[model samples]
Target: MKNVTFYLDFVSPYAYLAFHALPQALEGCSYRMEYRPIVLGAVFKANAVPSPAQQPAKRDWIRRHTTWLAEQAGLTSFAPAVNHPFSSIPLSRMALACSEDGAINRYVANAVFAHCWEAGGADPLDLQRLEALRAVLHKQWQPTIQSVDDEAIKQRLRANTDAALATGLFGVPSFVVDGELLWGLDALPMLRARLLG
Candidate 1:
C-alpha cells in the first residue's frame, strides 16, 4: 500500500522537520507519504488554541526547542521562518492545486519547505513565490494575489484543514495511518514502528 497521508503547513517548523525525518524513519517500509497542505492557523483556531507564534514566549521557545530537537534528531539546521506567523494561505492554495498535478506536488512541497524554513523566509506566503512555484509546476496562476483568491482555491484549502480536524489532527506534520493519528516529528520513530507492524 502507499504511505499514510501527512497533513502539514509551511508555517510550522515541526512540519519542516518531519519532511526531513520521514524518509529515513520509514526507510525500506513499503509506504509513501501523501502530502496535503493545510493551514495550521486554521487548525489552531478550530481547536481553540492559539498557534505558538501567536504568543511571544511560546514563539521564542519553539525556536530554541526545535533547534535542540533537530540536533538530537541529527537533522538539518532548524532555521525558524524569519517571518514567523505570516499568513500561509497563498502557499496552502498552491499546494492544494498541486495535489491534482501528477508528481508536481513533490516539487511544490520542497519549494515551500525551503522557502519557509531553511531560507529565512522573511516574507511568508508572498504571492510572487507562489506564482513562481505554479509556473514550475506547470499550473496556471495569475501573478497577482487574485491567483490564490479564487473561490475554488479558497474552499479547497479550507476543506483540507477541515479534513485534518476530522482526522483528529491538532497540529501540523501529523500522519494519519489507517485512521490512527500521529502528531509531530517526535512521533516518527513510532510511525516507523507502526509501519513495520
Candidate 2:
C-alpha cells in the first residue's frame, strides 16, 4: 500500500467536505493516509498567489459548490466557519500538539474539523470549543491544553507548510500519492483512479 499525504487546513470549506468524503471514496484501496495540517495562508503567501476567497465570484462559487458537495456526501451537519479566513493557527497548533509526529490521526483531525465547521459550532479558538475538543481527545490521546502553546507545535506546523509548498501544493484537500500531487475537491475521483490503478 502507498502512503497518501493529505494536506489540510480547517479554514477551507472544500477541505471539510473532502475530509468527510475521503474514506468512502477510497474504500478498498491499498493506501494509508497521513493527515498533515498546515496553514493555508502560509501556502498561499509562499506561492505568491491570492486566496480564492479574495475574488468575489470565486468565493461565491466555492460557498455554493461546497454546500452542494456536503449535501451530496450526506454531511448535513457541515457548516462554514463562523468567520472565513479566521485564524486557523490555533486549530492547527492544537492538532499538531496532539500529533505523534508531524502527522495527525484521523480521529483528532476529525474532532478539530467538526469543531471548526460543524453546524452551530463555535469559533475553533473559542475556549468552550477547545474544552469540548480536549474532552473528546482526552479519551484516547490525552492531549494537554497547554501543549498548544508549545513552541515545538508551532514549528511543526511551519515545517509542514514549508514541506507542502516545496511540493508545489498551493491548496488544501490536496493529496500526495507516490510523490504525485492531486489538488482540490474535484480531484477525489482522479485520486481514486490513480490509487486503484
Candidate 3:
C-alpha cells in the first residue's frame, strides 16, 4: 500500500480547510494518510517565507479569498486570529504526544484551529483551552502539554519542521508522496490523482 505524509500546522487556516477535505479527496486511493505536526514558525524562519498578514495587500487578499473558499467548502467562516507570527509549538507538541498514544489527534487540532481561526481567539497559546481540549479527548496525559516546554520535545519539534522545510515545502497543508510535494487544500485533487495512478 502506498502512503502520503501530511504536514500541517494548526495555525494555518489552509490546514483547517485541508483537514475537512482530505477524506473525500483520498477516497479511491490505496493510501494511508499520516499526519505530521510541524512548527509553522520554525519552517517560515528556515525558509524565509513571509506571513500573508505581514503584507497589507496580501493580508486583505487572503482574508477575502479564504472567507470565500471556506463558504464554498461549507465551513462557517475563515478568520485566523490576530497573533502576529502565531505560536503553535505547544499545540504541535501535544499533537505529537497524541500520536504516540495511537489516536488521530484531530480533536485537538480542530479545536486549536477553530479557537484561533473561527472563534477569533487572540491567544492560541491558551492553556485553559488546551486543558479543555485534553478533557474532551478523554486523555489523562497531563504531561503532554507540559512536555511542550521540555528541551528534548522542543528539539524534536524543530527537527520535524526542518525535515519538512527540506522537502521544499513553502506552506502549510502540504502533502508529500514519493518525494512529490503538493501544497494547499486545492492540491488535494492532484495528490489523489497521483496516489491513485
Selected candidate, larger lDDT, 1 vs 2: 2
- Between candidates 1 and 3, which one is better according to lDDT? 1
Candidates' TM-scores?
0.85, 0.92, 0.83
RMSD of each: 3.4, 1.9, 2.8
Candidate 3 minimal-lDDT segment of 10 residues: 97-106
Question: Residue 87 lDDT in model 2?
Answer: 83
Residue-level lDDT of model 2, residues 1-197, one tens digit each, is 88899999988888888888898889989999999999998888887999988787987787788778888888888877646657888888877877757899999888888888884645677788787787777754524436677877888898899889888998988999988999998899999999988
Rank the candidate models, highest TM-score first: 2, 1, 3
lDDT to native, each model: 0.75, 0.84, 0.72
Clashing pairs in 1: 3-32
Give the per-residue lDDT digits (tens) of candidate 3, residues 1-197.
67788888877777888988887778867987777778777677777877765688987676677778888888876666666346777777666555543223456666656766776545666678777655654473444445546665666676667778899998889989999999998898899889878
Model 3 alpha-carbon miss at residue 169, Å: 1.5
Cα shift from native, residue 188, model 1 (Å): 0.4
Local accuracy of candidate 1 as per-residue lDDT tens digits, 38-117: 87887888899977887999988888988787778775745676668777777777655555421225667877777677
